[model samples]
Target: MKEERVKKILSLLEKAYPDAKLVLHYNNPLELLIATILAAQCTDERVNKVTETLFKKCKTAQDYASAEQDVFEQEIRSTGFYKNKAKNIIACGKELVERFDGKVPDTMEDLVTLPGVGRKTASVLLGNIFGKQAVAVDTHVFRVSHRLELAKANDPDKVEQELCKIIPQEKWTRSCLVVGTHGRRTCIARKPLCNVCVVEKLCHSPDKIYSSRQE
Candidate 1:
C-alpha cells in the first residue's frame, strides 16, 4: 500500500532470489522475440529445449518468413499451439521484414504491431532488448503483484500502472524478474510456500500456505 513497504518487499525478493532474471535463452533481440512468442502457455525450460534447434534453422526474419509452415510447426510442436504460433511467427517475420527492415523494433508501439506481440511482450522487449523502463506483467507477475498487495487491478496493464506508481523506474525490470521468480519458486499459483517466503510477512494473500503440511 505504501511506497516504502513496496521497496522493502522488493529488497527482500532480491535477497531471496539473488540470481533471478529472465531464464529464456536468447542471443539477440530477434531470437528473444521469437522465444517470447513461443513461450506462451509454455515453460521457459521447454521453450529453450525447442529453440535449441529452431534458432539454428531460422537465423533471420527472412528465414522465419520463408520457413515452410509445416516444417516450422513440426519443429515447435512440443511448445504447444503449434498451428497458431507457427502462423504468428511467420507473420511476425514478414512484418519485420516489410516494415522494420528485418529488425526488432525497440518501441512499444512498433513492437505491438507485429503479429503475436501484445503489451506484455512489448514490455519485455523494451526492458531487456531496448534498455528501457518496463514491467512485463506475465501471469506470474500479475498473480504475485496481487498477492503482495502491491497492485489491486484486474487488468495486466492496470497492474503495471499501479506497480510503476510505487516502484522506481530503474527497478521496473528488477521487479518483474524477482517477483516473477518468487511466484514460480515460492509464491506459486496453487499453493504458495509462505512459510519459507522471505516476504511472507509483507504478503497478504488469502491463499498463502503457512504450514508445510498445508502445501
Candidate 2:
C-alpha cells in the first residue's frame, strides 16, 4: 500500500469515528482482560452481558482464582467454550496473583504468557491500558485490512506485521480501532454498505458494490 493512500484512509477513519472506543466495558485492566477472554468466539454484547454480573462477583485476580470451576463455567456459559474459558480465566487469575503482583502486565511479552491471553488480547491491553503502540488484529481488523489491501496475509500475526511496516508507529492503536469501527458499521463481513462508506472512493475491495473505485 502507498503511504499517501494509507494516510488518507486513516484520516477519513478518524474523521468518521472521532469518538471510537472499545465496545467492551471494563473498570480496569483486569476486567478488560477477562472480558477479552470471554469475547473470543463470542460477540461483544454477549461478553458484556456475562461480565455485567460476573464482574460484580469477581473483582480481583484472587477472586477469580478462588472461584469454583463448575460455578464459573456456569456463569459464563452464554459466551461459548465456557469450560476452556473458565479454566483459562482461573489459571490466568492465579498466575496474576502469583506473579506481577496481581496486576495485568503492560508488555506484550509478559501479557501473552498469561493463560487465554494471546497477541490480540495483549495488544488491546497494551494499547488501551499502557498507551502503547500495538495493532490488534481481531476479525474486524483482519477483514478490513484485507478489503482495503492494507494487508494481504491470512493470519493475524502476518497481517499485523505487514501493517506495522506501513502504518506509522504512533497511529497503530488508533488505526486498529478506527478500522474496526468501520468494519462494524459499514464494511461489514456479510454485506458491506459501500455506497455509504466515507472511504468508498479510496477502497479497492473486490467485494465493494456501488462504487466506481477499483484496485
Candidate 3:
C-alpha cells in the first residue's frame, strides 16, 4: 500500500476513535506483562477480570515465583491455558529476579528471553511501558494489516517489518492501537461493519461485505 494512502487511513482512524488505547488493565509493567501472557488466547476483558484479583494476590516477582502451582492455576483458569500460563508466570518471575533484579526488562532481547514473552508482548511493553516506538502485531493487527494491504506477508515478523517500512516511526504505536481497535470494532473477523468504518473508502479488501463507496 502507498504511504500516502496509509497515512490517510490512519488520519481517518484517528478521527474515528481518538480515544483508542490498550484495553488491558494493568497497574505496572509486571502486571501488564502477566496480563499479556494471559491474553494470548483470551480477551482483554477476561484478562482484566482475572487480573483484578490476581494482581492483588501477586504483587511482585517473588509472589508469583513462590505461588503454589495448583492454586495459581486456579486463579488464572478462566483465562484459558492456565497451566502453561501459570508455569510461565512463575518462571518469568524467577528470571526477572535472578537475571534482571526483579525488574521488567525494557529491551526486546531481554524481554523475549522470559517464558511466554514473545515479540508481540515485548512490543507492548516497549511501547506502553518503556515509551519506545514499537508495533505490536497481535491477532487483530495481523488480520487488519493483511486486509488493508498494509502488509502482504503471512508471517507476523514479516508483516511487522513491512509495516515499519511504510508507517512513520512516530506513528508506530498509535497505528497498532488504532488498527487493532478497528479490527475489533469495524473490521471484525466474522462481520465487518464496512459501511460505518471510517477508512471504508481506503480499504479494498475482498472480504469487505459492504462498501460505502459503492453506495
Candidate 4:
C-alpha cells in the first residue's frame, strides 16, 4: 500500500512540476558548493542575488582560498551568519584545492569532509552537480515527505534513507527536485493549497482537503 502511494505521488508530482530542479544559480561544481553553503537558513533567491558578485570575486577554489576574509564576509553578509560562512568558504576552498586538486569531490563521503558541509549540502552536489542518485532532505523535502507519507523519520538522514528505499534509484535525485518544488508552490508550511494541489488525493495529512470545504 505504501509503495503504491509512493509511486502515485511521484507520478503526480512529476507531471505537475515537469521543470522542477535546483533553483540555486551556479555555473559549476565549485559555485554550487558555495551557493549551497550560502543557502543555509536562507532562500535560494537571496543566495542567487548575493552570488552575482560573490561568484565574480571568487570563481575557483584557489581564488576563494586566497580571498581576504573580511572582503568575503562583506560580499556574502546578506546571506546571514557571514562570519562563519566566510570562514567556512575559505577553509573549504583551501581544502578543495589542496586535497581534491581544485575539483569538487563527487562522492558523498568526500564532499561531507569539507568544512561547513553536511549531508544536505553534499547531497545537493551529488544530485545536482554530479547527477548522482541522491535525496537531499531540505526543509521542503522533510515536510512534504511526512505529509505525503513517504517518510516518518524526525531527522533528515533517516528521512533520506526511507525515501531512498521506496523511490527508485534512477528517480531519487529528480524526486528531491520535484518534491521540493511542490512544497514551495503548493504544500507550503503555513497554509498549503491542498484544494489545488495535484497530489492532494495522495497526501496523508488530515488537513489536505479541509480548506476546500470552507470555500
Candidate 5:
C-alpha cells in the first residue's frame, strides 16, 4: 500500500541522513528568522558564511532595527537580492522589536505576519527554534515529496497539507529535515540518481527508462 511505501521511504531516508538538521547557522530565534529570510534563493552554505560576521555585527532585533540600511545591504550583497533582503530584514526586525519584545514569535500565525516571513520560513522557525511540529516545504521537500509520491500537490502549502495528513505529528519536523537531505543528495531536481536511490521502486518517475539504461 501507499502508506507502507511512505514508511519505508522515511525509514531509508532517516537512516541515510541520520544527522540531518537545519543547516542555517543561527544562535537565537531572532537570528534564525533573519537568516531564513536572507536564505531565499540562496544556499545555506553561503548564508552561513555571510551570517558569521553579520551575526556579530547585529546580535539582536534592536541591533538590526537600528542598523544603517546601506551597511546591512553591503554586508549581505554577496547573498544576492541584497536590496530586497536588506529591506525585509530591517522591516522584520522592527516588527519583532515592536511586536514581540525583540523575541521571535513562536507561533506560525504571528511569525508569518512579520515582513518577508512566509509559511515556509515560519515553519522552519517553529520547528527548529520552538520545537513545534511543522514541515518546512522548501524546494528540497517540494521536489522530493513529489518524486517519492508522498505528495502530488503542485503548491508547497498543499504538499505540506498532504504530508501532514499522512505523517504523524511527531515526525513532521524530522521528516522535513530527512526529505530535504535526500533531495539534495539523491532525489535531486535534475538527473536524480534513480539507480542508486533507495526509494526508486516507490518513485513514480520512468522506472523502465532507468532500468533499460542500466542494462
Candidate 6:
C-alpha cells in the first residue's frame, strides 16, 4: 500500500474506533504476561474474567513460581489449555526470579527466553508495557492485515515484518490495536459487516459482503 493510502486508513481507523484499547486488563507486566498466555485460544473477555481472581492470588513471580501445580491449573482452567498455561506460568515465574530478579525483561531477546513467551507475546509486553516500537501479530492482526493487504505472508512473523516496513514506527502499536478491533467488530471472520465497516471502500477482499445499512 502507498504511504498516503496507509495514512488515510489509519486516520479513519482512529476516527471509527477512538476508544479502541487492549481488552485484557492488567496493571503490570506480570499480569499481562499471565493474561496473554491464558488468552491463547480464549476470548479477551474470558481471560479478563479469569484474571480478575488470578491476579489477586498471584501478585508476584515468587507467588506463581511456588504455586501448587494442580491448584494453579484449576485457577486458570476456564481459560482452556490450563494445564500448559499453568505449567508455563510457573516456569516463567521461576525464570523471572532467577534471571531477572523477578522483574519482566524489557527487551525482545530477554523476554523470549522466558517459558511460554514467543515473539507475539514479547511484542505485546514491549509495545504496551515497555513503551517500545513493536507490533504483536495475534489472530485478529493476521486476519485483518490480510484483508487490508497490509501484509500477504501466511506466516505471522513475516507479516509483522512487512507491516513494520509500511506502518510508521510511532504508530505501530496503535495501528495494531485499531485494526485488531476492526477485525473483532466489523471485519469478522465468518460474517464481516462490510456495509458498516469504516474501511469498506478501501478493502479489496473477496469475502467482503456489501449491503445498504438501515442506519
Worst 10 residues of 2 by lDDT: 206-215
Model 1: per-residue lDDT, tens digit, 57-101?
899999999988899999999999999999999999999999999
lDDT of 3 by residue, 1-215 (tens): 48789999889988888899999999799999999999999999999999999999899998988888999999999999999999999999999989988999999989999999989999999998899999899999999999888999988888989999999999899999999999988899988998888888878899999876845
Clashing residue pairs for model 3: none
What are the lDDT figures for the candidates, one per model? 0.91, 0.93, 0.92, 0.91, 0.88, 0.91
Alpha carbon lDDT of residue 206, candidate 3? 93
Enumerate residue pairs that collide in model 1.
none
List, residue by residue over 75-140, the lDDT tens digit for candidate 2.
999999999999999999999999988999899999999999999999999998889999999999
* Sliding window of 10 residues with minimal summed lDDT for model 4: 206-215
lDDT of model 3 at position 6: 91
Q: How far is 165's C-alpha from truth in model 5 (Å)?
A: 0.8
- Which is the leading candidate under TM-score? 3
What local lDDT score does residue 115 receive in model 4, on the 0 to 100 scale? Answer: 98
Clashing pairs in 4: none
| Candidate 6 lDDT, 1-215, residue by residue in tens | 48988898889989999998889999999999888888999999999999999888899999999999999999999999999999999999999999999999999999999999998899998998888989999999999999888899999899999999999999999999998889899889899989888887788888888845443
Off by over 4 Å in 3: none
State each candidate's clash count: 0, 0, 0, 0, 0, 0
Candidate 5 Cα errors over 4 Å, as ranges:
206-209, 212-215
- On TM-score, who's better, 2 or 6? 2
Q: Could you tell me how far off, in angstroms, the CA of residue 181 lies in candidate 3 after the best superposition?
A: 0.9
Model 5 Cα lDDT, one tens digit per residue, 144-204: 8877778888999999899998888999999999999988888777778777777766666
Instruction: Select the stronger candidate by lDDT from 3 and 5.
Output: 3
